[model samples]
Target: MTEFQTQIQAATRIVQTVYGLSVEWQPIPGEVEVVQACIGGREELPIYLTQSGEQTLCICYLWHDDEIEPSRRTELLEAMLDLNIPMPLSAFARVEGYFVVFGALARQSRPEDLAQELAALSENALEALEAFADYLKQ
Candidate 1:
């Protein structure tokens, strides 16, 4: 198999083994391959992984949705930007309908590195949710 394919498979295995998480691959027509993993002990969060290109894979977890309540949109966005300031490794991204905390990894990245990224992403995402709740109150 090609290097990209090999790397993808290796990543899948590493995530499963390290996180005790199962990955479901879902490939869309004419798009890069995508995989979904439900993390947390109770499967509380869903993380989406997709190949960013031939050599990078993007790992993303839903952070928040600024459009949920139109009245607070501006405030919510500002809060999100504020939360982004001190964050390390991952950054907040506004995806199609939600804000996501995302980071990219080299296609051939080590399993431990992938695990660290996933752990950091998951932990920070949880913090962001709490921060968003506080932001909405302001």
Candidate 2:
């Protein structure tokens, strides 16, 4: 298995036992956001976790056919880490029904940068941006 494949194995085990979710990891072409995918297009509610491990990160993905709700995604991840709060992003939509790509908020660090990049906002996204701003404000 590739190193990332190993990470997926470890992350999946860790997330499942810890968060009560079973996630299967799949590697997508291009960018590396580490998102979860549902089996056979089941609505399993995807979960993406970004945590700093060793030097880099072990971002974990868990998919839900109900669709991975970003708020729930962030909540699940933060809960596992016991983090106070987490950066959030909007959900993903399947263009062709075969797959859907979750919208990534930012690389990691400086959440405000993500807010800034979005440039505008929907009410919910705006709320998250406002929360991020509040985090920066503190």
lDDT of 2 by residue, 54-128 (tens): 222222122233443544655544443442234344332333422222344423434333222222112223333
Global Cα lDDT for candidate 1:
0.63
Off by over 4 Å in 1: 1-31, 61-67, 134-138
RMSD (CA, Å), each prediction = 3.9, 14.3
Please report the candidate that would top TM-score against the real structure.
1
Q: Write the per-residue lDDT of candidate 1 for residues 1-138, one digit (tens) a residue.
A: 545445545656776887676554444345556655555462556566666544454556454464346677788778878878688767888767667888777766775676667666767777877776644433
Q: How many backbone clashes does candidate 2 have?
A: 12
lDDT of each: 0.63, 0.36
- Where model 2 places Cα greater than 4 Å from the true spot, the runs are 30-138
The TM-score of candidate 2 is 0.30
